[model samples]
Target chain A: MIRVQSEAFDAGAELNAFSTQAAGAGAVVSFTGVVRDVTGGLSGMEIEHYEGMTEKALGAIRADAMQRWELADSLVIHRFGRLEVGEVIMMVATASKHRKDAFEAAEFLMDYLKSRAPFWKKEITADGADWVASKDEDEDALSRW
Target chain B: MQVLYFAWVRERIGVPREEVETSAVTVNDLVVELRAREERYDAAFADTSALRVALDQELAEFDAPLSGVREVAFFPPMTGG
Candidate 1:
């Protein structure tokens, strides 16, 4: 499953729901990204996403993960729009018969989500706002898989 | 066809989307036509390397043909997640 929306979601609830859905799986791994104030003076973060393209990109990535890993099920839920510090930005969960597959798939999903998806983040602070630039490390990480 | 911009690209162009009529054959050609329109477009498209393009919601190269593409989007490298 893949979801892109502006509303916030409960990560615990989502994880539980996904685990329940992947009933017979022996292992499940999940990652949740939080809105952290990297800069102390930060007030909030504004996330802008391509409405029609966001879903499409996420779906493609999810499908790719499913194909590459021995997984029973997967879930990706990402939120957009104005978000305050400490809020959940996104989450990814993968279920498989073994711990290795679940762990690898979750990491793979996060790596792709960081660069491939069509979403931009703007850090808002007392001074003003600035668009978050793509890090070289993020791009370099893709070469592994 | 429709042209769309996002993030700082939209800020520079002053619009999120627009309808375009062009005889351009490829994504690069369409970009050149847009750049010739005004200073804002020119600035937004100043460096192709700093931007990414999509055709009909799928990512595409600048040299990709636009023969039947109905939508073209330009924006910076995504900083998602």
Candidate 2:
């Protein structure tokens, strides 16, 4: 499953729902990304995404992960628009028969989402608003898979 | 063709999307035409290395041929996840 919405979502509820759907799987791994105020200067973050392409890209990434791993099920929910600090921005859940497959698939989903997805984040601060630049490390992370 | 820009590229270009008529055969060729049109486009495309392009919503190289492409989008490297 893949979702791209402007409304906020409950990560815990989403995880539970995904786990329930993957009942046959013995291991379920999940990851949630929160809007962190690392510098304490961030008032909020604005996520911009291609309206038509965001879902398509996410679905492709999830499909790729499923193909590489023995995943029973997978879910990805990414929120857009204005998000305050500590708000949940996105989550990925993967269920597999083994712990390694579940964990690795979740990581793979994240790695691809970081760069391949069309979303862009802007940090709002008292000083000024600035778009977050892509990190070299994030691009390098894809080489592992 | 429909041309789109996102994030900083949109900010710099001063528009989110527009219709463009061009004889350019590649993404880079289109960039050159856009850059020649106005100061904003020139500034937005000053450094091609800082930008990424998509042909019909799929990631594409600047040198990729533009034939049959209905939509083209240009934006900075994504900061997602």
* RMSD (Å) of each candidate, 1 decimal: 0.7, 0.6
Model 2 stretches astray by more than 4 angstroms: none
Give candidate 1's TM-score.
0.98
Chain B TM, every candidate:
0.98, 0.98
Which lDDT tens digits does candidate 1 get at residues A1-145?
9999899999999999999989999899999999999869889999999998999999999999999999999999999999999999999999999899999999999999999999999999999999999999999999998
lDDT of every predicted structure (CA atoms) = 0.95, 0.95
**Residue by residue across B10-44, what tens digits does model 1's lDDT show?**
99999999999999999999989999999999999
Evaluated at residue A105, the lDDT of candidate 2 is: 96
In candidate 1, the second chain superimposes onto the true chain B with a TM-score of 0.98
Report the lDDT of model 2 for residue B3: 100
Please provide, for model 2 over A52-93, each residue's C-alpha lDDT reduced to its tens digit, 9 standing for 90 to 100. 888889989999999999999999999999999999999999
The TM-score leader among the candidates is: 2
- Top candidate (DockQ): 1
